[model samples]
Target: MNVETQKVKIFMQKHDNQKRALISILQDIQAEFNYLPKEALQDVAKTLEIPLIHIIGVATFYRSFSLEPRGKHQATVCTGTACHVRGGPKILDEFERKLGVEAGHTTEDRQFTLETVACLGCCAIGPVVVVDNEYFAHTSIREVGSILKKYRKKEKDNE
Candidate 1:
């Protein structure tokens, strides 16, 4: 089997190949690949004896799952009522301008994927920006560049 398929099989094996563990298996696959690859999904469907449509349904049902490849880092801005009133749209616009990509797209360099959440549930800290699970509370347009720089530097250092 190819490397991707092998990885999917391993994830399935980890969950004992039970249908009930489908979500967990898909999570494992996404965590490894940064998205649910078509081949991996097909392998999962065939191995689990589940319909591909059902698998796709489950995958698309979750906002966390992405069929398309995502960037090395995920940057999410809060745009809920509280955040929106607190310059959240401006913050998102700054990010889009800095990253040269829209909110729902990944950068050309594949370093970051920009997204927006309705609410981060931290209303007191309105206008929150999260990068790779690190929450930046009370974010502002001015802070956007530094946030992108921080992640970009990490990518460079890793290289």
Candidate 2:
């Protein structure tokens, strides 16, 4: 069988092919592949005896699920009203310039994906940036280079 089918089998085995665990199964698949492959989705439909449309609906309905591949590092800039007034747009532009990818897109090297959020709920710390799981509060354009450098360094070190 194809690799996608094999992967689906493994994830199905993990969840015992229970229909109730569809979301959990999809999560495991996404965690393994960064995004859900179409073939895997088909396998899931067949394995769980669920309608393909239902599976597609659930996957598309969830913002956490990505139909496209994501980068190794996820960088989110808050563009809420508070953050907007605090130079958030400038910070996002700086990231786009430095990373060579616009917001909502990943770098060609797949090292970083830049995204903007309506709010991170840390309005007091306007213009916040969350890279991976680390938060950088009160960020400024001048600090963008250093912040990206730190992540790049970490990536290199891990390599």
Q: What's each prediction's TM-score?
A: 0.94, 0.91
Model 2, TM vs. native:
0.91
Tens-digit lDDT string for candidate 1 (1-159): 788888888899999999999999999999999999999999999999999999999999998899989998999999999999999999999999999999888999888999999987889987889999999999878889999999889888989
How well is each residue in 1-159 modelled by candidate 2, as lDDT tens digits? 877778779989998899999999999999999988888898899989999999999999986788778899999999999999999999999999999998988899988989999998989988899999899999999999999899899988989
Model 1's alpha-carbon lDDT is 0.92
Clashing pairs in 2: none
After superposition of all CA atoms, the RMSD between model 2 and the true structure is 1.6
CA lDDT, every model vs. true structure:
0.92, 0.91
Looking at model 2, residue 41 earns an lDDT score of 91
